[model samples]
Target chain A: MLPTSKSCILCETEARKIYAAIFGGEIPLAVLNRFVVATQRLNANVPPAETDAYYRALLACDDLEALEVAARYTRKLPLLTRKFRLMAYLAETVPETQDFFINDRSNLLAGLWAAFTGGLRTAVKLPAGLWLLRRCAHV
Target chain B: MSELIIVGSGAAGAAAALALADLGLRPLLLDVGHTDPGAGPRVEGNLYDYRRRHDTFGLYIGEDLHGLSDVLTGETGIAKLNAPNAAFVVQDAARLSPVEASGFDAIQSFALGGLGNAWGAGLYRFVDADLAGFPLRAADLAPYFDRLTGEVGISGAGDDLTPFFGATAGLQPPLRLSYNADRFYRSYAHRRAAFLAQGIQVGRPRLGVLSQPRDGRPGCDYSNTEFWQDAPYLYTPAVTLRKLIAAGQIDYRPGVLVRSWTETAAGVVVDATDAATGAALRFEGRTLLLAAGAIGTSKIVLRSFRDYDTALGLLENPAVQIPFVLPASIGRRLDAQAFGLTQLNLVWESPDHGRLQGSLLELTSPMRAEFFMRFPLAARANLALVRSLLPAMLLMQLFYPGAAQPPAQLSLREDGTLRIRGHENAISVRELAPLLGLMRSAGLWTAPMLIFKPATGHAIHYAGTLPMTESPARYQCDPTGKLAGAEHVYIADSASFTALPAKNMSFGMMANAMRIAEAAARR
Candidate 1:
């Protein structure tokens, strides 16, 4: 029934405080339930603002190892941003052999550059279901 | 008539042109390359290959005369070898050989804008350590920094050098961090304080891009792979040349290369040859400034004073590259380039969350090796190999490679020409350019050395040959940027650089050139 049940490779576990901290301040009320469901799928159903704060905290506090650990549990791209294109790019393409996270890394930025630059052109036809892509590293 | 006659059109030469324009005295600005006055984007080499993902990696096995290029031997030596089809003024010139021991300024750049066309727009200034043995200070260059930022339009954040000098010349609101950059963010913005324990400081890159745009230049589109190819995004000096021409400050002379300059008691006279027709024309001036780049200006000096300065050897400097892998998880985080300094990360840990002194905050992006995967490689047997393994090349340059290069020598051959030998992980320019690429070297044989081992060198960070210093052992220019030996010659280039070139040498070089012109104008 959940997205992670199908695509996620990492083990799904109960969400930590960091999860709630990453989805900080901004989330439309209509999509809040969808975000809650996606996280519930990852068992990371913390509050949105907490998720964002945690993301920032990770930037200010955690090292790469901790960041990786957090990444593994993150099952879905935040539905609020509709960064599904980034996610699809990752899943469709084979991850790199050497740099473990490169596929995720490339797709994330390339997708963002594309989405951000193409913001005014065609937001309607976009995938991942969000006006702006976030959380998901899909290219 | 003049003190020095500089040749070539590029960063070095353009800086000279700008410097002279400020002085109110018009120095002879002749270009031998493509000096046509055409409007609109005129991209060479990049236009055809713009959209394609091509890896410019490889080796050129040939005989070269001057010790300028790095394609043949990684080392710089005066040896001649197999030549290109026909070395014309542009891509199609008459076949020519160099005269043995002929002091010729066989420098690059004949275009109206010089080498500024192919720049990536990464600008940085030297710190105290970068200055090292040099006898110059940030205060001395204060005004030039002011003048250049006013003219060139640099973008980015940080206290590296620009902030201290002050002004938001061309920075837009600040570019957004790509989601990909989070991997290297820690190593970048949130770097470990341990480096401070080791005296290492990681910061963001301060570049010359507008978060917003100004000076008639448009905002960055960010669609192109490299900024150099960002036709509509960047505002190169050629753009500035048009403005200068409109202002009636810059005169136009396409196809004219100053063959030589002879200074007499009255003034200086420059001899130029129409690169296309070989027809010689002359220009005279009260003062002269050398804008030919490091190897360029020095070669010009070599041509000017055959035995004037014995310190012209490229051997005097050896730029070193010190690279290291960021802590595991940090690699991805720090490798991401956002609106901050992705060019150079000044890493130093703070007592709290370590702060980065760079221009952009790392977000995420494809690595060089990984990005190169987009191109076709003969080595790859299948689509799987190319598709799967390409985008993982995020390597941080611990310190810019070629940290110190001895005064390199670009000899003028019998018939008249020159060459160089070099690569990048740090600058841009192809003097002995278009050398072997990093990805190619990384892909083939590197002895398993990390990116640091075979550190890269780009012509972007220009320096040495004619360093500006008060002492003979220190530099060749005065505090005001005048060449020490010559009466009226001044260098407004990296050659006048007494320190290791900073992240944005163009801005620095531009500023330095302005300073030299300011002084010359006063005289």
Candidate 2:
């Protein structure tokens, strides 16, 4: 009955491998390897420690929960870095896992949250549902 | 005694002072000079991040998009210091006298740089046709144009607009045009011959901004922070005034509001009130230069004429905003570039009719999102879907140069305040159809709520109150910018403009102020 039923199951398998590798440290490290590759495409000058912390947080939480945690970590990054990390994380994760959180409601809420938080520049980080809860903190 | 005394510390005032000082004459300048303290919260590397974040969240979240336009243009001063009707930081309703209005309201900024702080910095020059009934010809004002252009570091290229806008020697390389503007120029360039035959000209705008680093200020970093905060790197009057003051070339006095002036045997006596204290102040100078904007200058002149109140012509251009979407550029990704006040300018002229100039400014940032809020209530509910249309939006402001300018009258009240009366010309879609048609011909199309009605004084290119005339008995000022009744007083601001064309008036105002000041200095 979920909206994510139409998405690719390959995304679920890949997301599991990445999640297991992050915490269990016994998987192929394929998901982690892709993440490191994605960081190369980022335009922002993100610090090594910040990147380390971002990955560590995902290991501690579920896929969507990790997204929220990563969004908070983005406060310390430059606007460019924040956007790249959020979008990259969403792109790398399994499509089925991605759809679990990224419904129409979450998309709209993320845009509103980003716009309210900063403006277009701040809203740049809202491609996924990661940045939604920051609006609540303001309230 | 100082040889010259200047009123207002904004663009015209700053230009007048610098022009006088260049001749080694340091004029005494007076202004309310409301310096709003606290550069709102700064993000690392991005100074304006905090301010934008706080304002966007508070104003736009769940709010009717219809109100966002008012918030940007009406609620707060869009420019850093030019708060409407503000006599500095605080809008003391009691201290300020209200001007009765009808269709539109004229906003006044009592800050140091005057309205120059909030100016678009579209530094286009007026040719002979543009300066049609003025005392000085285009040739007479050409050198001052060169001097000011060189001093301000205007960013423009000599293009098809050169013959009309005139050629200046020192202009910084023009900024890279936004995707939409660039695409439009290419589209126009491909059909350049046909467009030229139709009496329509498209070219890059001559901006009062630096394309490359000059002086100590850095070149524009393409931060898209121009509208919201002070990009000091851009050419604000404060940048020019600061340098002049540091060099000891100008004496700037703040918190002083000039109420009236009287000509005396030895010099001109200026009566003023200190905004900081409720105390009377007096200053005397051999010459008085009034650059206190069009409305402010007229008010001072009318108040000085205690024996009688007079009606002055308030010439203003009737303006309309034409927002269109380029089909090719829709839904494209946004880029970080030097977003200036205007990217390209479109001018249409006919021998039988007259001239209309459209200053094209493409909305690239989330500022584009604000326009979508004007969409229907049902459409705006899906913010994510609504945000996609942002990259495609382009707003072209069409200004009618030779329209019938309804006059604003300045009269002295018994309460010792000057009152202004005027009506703004209405914007009719019927009148703007031809302009819209031309845009459509160029592959640009509009949707509903695209063309919005601009309030009177919304264009903000106000002038012709105390216009220069051969018959001093008829007009307030003569060719030398001297007020008819006052011997030592001169109106150097836009108040002395006989006609205001569709082009941005800040450059013309600053150049004219310098012209007047130079004449007075020699006299």
Candidate 3:
């Protein structure tokens, strides 16, 4: 059985492969790990109900852009557009690892989403959205 | 004559009237009741006495009084308050209130000011993050919010100048913080330094109360007395219409009860009966706004469900109130933000006391919500035995998201009065412990929170119905707040909300409402 046709709720793509190879995908691992760590920090203060969603989004998204885009579908339905914008600044603010490949698969992961968003928009995002979405959870 | 006939004279009705008046549209406004400002029930005689024929509280409890031809036939009207029998039927109905299977709560207020009249005036804005996913931003909503604030005048501070403002913030100047509120923030700020450290805003409470007269409203007295009926600074819709009537811009048709409507290509011919005469009049308007509160508006929409398939969805106040005991203050402390909801747990330090912790983090001294708590009394004594301690109950409301499914049938009897009933997922004590703890630690619980249990009493923040969908087929209204089947008709109140956030949703909706109106007007 073709494991059920699914479309990324954001991108609205029906199992369409993302052109991560050409347009680029995934955040640097250091930043991805940083988001993972920050997501942990976010949980310490907020309600567990809210924390779990935030943590899950950070773990799944490969980059900040994808994560922020994922937030467009998360249950809490938080607005993370600014957080997505902030990721660029955040990346520029921090030092990067020399061995990092910007499009590394290790950096790629699934992120959270607002329930109402559609297929492709929810899926096939870059680290820019993911990085911001992860940071917004700390908010 | 432009032939504008406004339906209710509450916040939205009055605001619309005033806004229209400013726009040079002097349409006739009709209310079922009339009153004089600053008059202690001594102002005037009923200009149009629908009294004998009108349902006494038709608008008050219209959503629940399902089968009543008595009021119209002069068989029944207002119920006596003091007499146990006056509202006894309603009480009994409360006993048999339906579970959430029906998917909505049926609440209506007939008080003169409409729902906004009874509002606690806790004004706050939707966070920028609240608006992040959507295409619209603060700049897009600037004009409408500016006009609303210029006309209505809200009072607020923190969310104001923080570049963090979404289009929904700064609707009006913010309200002043209460004594208890000032104390609560000072304590709670220190407890949660980690979150507050990230430049995350702890709100400066805002409210619809005016600090100074703008558009003729008086500054708040801080008395908070209108807890029941009429008082200044209450900011109920009644006050606006009542004042506008004095200005000769709006007229009183206080007891006019809407019977039904016939859908027409142009619009609807709303059949209504005069409360005093029992006579029928079919009023016409090119435009109509149902700014009636959640249940009332939804009830009317449900009444007209045949015209629109998506009419029945109610952005339910899947209201949850969590009560928690503050590790710091425990029981003796009480506090909140401007609009009766302390949405933020602000932590700050007191000038006098020096403690190790810099920011006084709160969400510590949670409340004993009357509804959530089960203070086990000596077996056999119902909660009534110790009703004096009702104020002791607390609840920090967790404004959850969910919509009440629209009722399949919303029918009104010959008298133009109807009744509806509904509830939510009632969690067990253990399940509610954390929520209760949250409230207690946060100190946002209300007195009703202490009684046997409260169910959505003040979960008044409305939304989750009439959402904007990418597919026009899936939505009742677009993100712009226009109902799908009908053009030139839109929802300006909380009913336009599809996703209910934690903050007060009115500011957000009004901003959208104004934008929709502006767009519609341009068209």
Candidate 1 regions with alpha-carbon error over 4 angstroms = A1-139, B1-8, B19-27, B33-107, B127-129, B159-171, B186-191, B225-230, B307-311, B315-344, B347-389, B398-410, B413-462, B471-475, B501-504
Per-residue CA lDDT of model 2 for A1-139, tens digit only, reads 1112244243344345344422232323433344333333331234555534544443343433224433544553232223322222332222232221122222334444533433442234343324433432232
Could you tell me the lDDT of residue B469 within candidate 1?
67
DockQ of each: 0.01, 0.02, 0.01
Q: Tens digit of lDDT per residue, candidate 3, span B302-401?
A: 5555333333444443434443332222222122222233323322221221100111112211111111113322101111111222222223443333
**Whose TM-score is greatest here?**
2
Off by over 4 Å in 2: A1-139, B43-97, B338-340, B350-353, B365-369, B377-385, B416-418
Between candidates 1 and 2, name the one with more favorable lDDT. Answer: 2
lDDT of 1 at B270: 72
- Candidate 2 positional error at B334, Å: 2.7
- Cα deviation in Å at residue A58, candidate 3? 63
Best by lDDT: 2
TM-scores for every candidate against the unseen true structure: 0.57, 0.74, 0.53
